[model samples]
Target: MGVLLVGGLMACAPAVSGPSQAALAAPRVALEAGHPERLRLVVMGDQGTGTETQWQVARAMAAVCAAQGCDLGAALGDNFYPAGPREVTSPLFRERFEVPYGPLGIPFIMVPGNHDESWLWGGDGASPRGAEVQVAYSRVNPQWVMPARQYQASVSGLLDLFVVDTAPLAAYLPSVRPQERPGGPWDAAQRAWLAQAVNQSAARWRLVLGHHPLYSNGKHGDAGAYDHLPFTFQRGGAVQALYAVACGQADLLLSGHDHALQLFAPQPDCPGTWTAVSGAAGEVGGERRGRRPAAFEVYGQPGFLWLEITPQTLTLWAYVVGEGGAVTGTEIARLSKGS
Candidate 1:
C-alpha cells in the first residue's frame, strides 16, 4: 500500500490503486464549524470470551468514552464463545457481556458470529436457537440490541445502520455439516432487505455491519476464499455478489471475524465503501497474512475503533492498545466525497 497523508496523519492507501490527487489534497476541515453535532461511536467484535483481555478492552473503552463521549456502540459479532448462551437467561450474558461493557452506558447494536451460531465449535453450524436467544435478550435489556437476525437501525438521525447475519451464509457453503444449514432461504431475504433498506433510507450516512468481512488482510481473508478454502471460493463469490447491493450503495462495510484491526481502501468491487475489521476486542494474535492491501493493519494487540460522523464527513480513529490496556497510538482518517 502507498502512503497517503490525511490531516498530517500518514495512512497507507489501498495497494490495488492509488487515490486521486484531489483526495490527497483535501483539507482537514474542523468537524464543529457550522455543521450538525457529530455522533461518536465505539466499534468492537468477537469479544464475548469473558476473559481478562475482554475486560481490559472494555476498560479502555470506558476510559475513552469518559474522556471523550460515545453515543452508541457497534458489537460486530462472536458475542459468545464456543457456542452461544444456552438461553436468554444464561449467566454467560452477565459474566461475558453485561458486566464487562456495562460501564459504557450505551446501547450496542449486535450481530451474531459463527461461534454464536455454532453448537460444538465454530466450524460446525448449530441450531438457530443460539442466535435467537440473543435477540430475545434485547427485550430484557435495553443496552443489548438485536431485534432480529438481520435488521436496520437509525442512529441519532445521522446514520442508518444495516446489520447482516453472515454466519448462516458461511455455514451454508459447501463441505459444511448438513445440520448447520439454515432451514429456510436466509441469504435471499437478507439481500433483499439490505438492498431495499439502503435505497429507501434518507440518512446522511449508511453503514452495513456484519460478522464476516467482505475484505480482510488477516487469516480468514475476504468473503470469498475464507480460511483459504478453494472449494468455498466459488460459494464465497456468490457471497460477494449478494453483498453487492451494500458495497455499491452503502458508505461503509464494517465487520469483525479476523481477530485483528484492519482498514482497507476501497476495492474495485466495493468501490464506494471502505472495509473495516475490528475483531480484536478479546482475542489477539494473528499474522498480517497480507491477503489484501490495507490502509492500516495491526495484530497481536487488543483494541477497537472510534468514529465521529457528521453530514459532510466521517472520521475514523483506529486505536491500538498496549500491555496495560492503555492506548498506544492512533491512526486517523478523514473521509469525504473529495477525500
Candidate 2:
C-alpha cells in the first residue's frame, strides 16, 4: 500500500472543542518521486449498525483490499446508528467499527453524519457532544483519522481531500435546536477555509468529503430543497451556499446521506465536479426517489466506491456485495486533466 500524507489545514479558525492548533500544524511527509504517484482507497458510508449486513460489507471491503491493495478508507458518515458514541470507550467503536474493519488495516478518513450527531431516533436532531466524542477517539485509535470536525488532508501529492462536517449545515432535520449546535462561528469559518483551500490547492485532484450531498438521486434528494419540500429550501439553503465554493473548483464531491449508491454526472450547478453517494455500506435503502437522474444507481444491496488515482487519471469503480460477502466490481469511471 502507498503512504497517505495526512495533515490538517490550519487556515480556518479552529472550533472550540476540536484538536489543538499545534496538532493541526503537524508536518506532512513527502512522497518519493521515482515512480508515478498512485493511490487506491475505498469509500463507504452509513455503516455503523453492527449487524450481520455491516459485517458482510466489511468482509467484502477486506476481500477487495486484500486483492487490489487499498492504502486508505473514507467513511462518509453515520458511523453509528440512532446516535453516536457517548464516549471514546463506547463498545460500538470496537464492535461496529474497529472489529469489522480490522482486516482492512487502513486508516479511515471520516466525517459525521446526521445520525452520528443525533441524540434520538429518526435522526431528527443533533447531540451537543456526539461529534466531539468521536474527535477525541481519534487520539486513541490510529486507524480512525478524524483529527477535527473539518480539516484538509494532502494524500501523497495526488489528492487534496477537504473533509467537512455537514451535520450543522444540513436542514432536513428539525429537531436540532440552535442550542444543540456547535459553539462559536463554525459555519462561516469552514466555508471560508474550503473556498481558499480548493482554489489554492496544487494537488493533482481536489476532492471534498462530507456527510450530505449537494445533489443526489436517493431519498434525501439535493441540498437547498431536501426531501423535495419548499419549506426545507430556506432551512437547507446554507448547505448549498457552503458547497458552492467547490462547484467548479474541486474535482469531485463525495457524500452519503441517503442509503444508496449513486453517481451523478456533473450538473449545471456544479459543472466541473462529479457527485457520488455510497451510503449502502450497512443497511440498503429503496430505489431512487425520482428527484433527479443518476448515471449509475445501486440499492437494495450493500456497496462502496473504489478509486485509483495516478498522476494522469482518476479511475473509480463501484462495488456491490452480495450475500455471504460475495464481492463484485463493475462500471469503471475515470477523470483526467492534462498535467
- Displacement of residue 106 (Cα, Å) in model 2 is 0.9
Q: What is the lDDT of every predicted structure here?
A: 0.72, 0.74
Per-residue lDDT of candidate 1, residues 1-339 (tens digit): 344332222222221122232231111111111224477779999888888888889888888888777777889988988779868889999998888887676667788887888755653434566777897797677667676777766644567787887786666333243432333344555676678778887778888888888888788778767776655532355457557888768888889988999988889978878889999998787888865678888898999999988777898888777877778547567787542
* Candidate achieving the largest lDDT: 2
Q: Candidate 2's C-alpha lDDT?
A: 0.74
Which residue runs of candidate 2 sit more than 4 Å off their true CA positions? 1-36, 171-184, 229-235
Local accuracy of candidate 2 as per-residue lDDT tens digits, 239-278: 7777898899998899988888888878998898888988
Q: Which stretches of candidate 1 lie over 4 Å from their true place?
A: 1-36, 172-184, 230-235, 337-339
Error of 2 at 226 (Å): 1.2
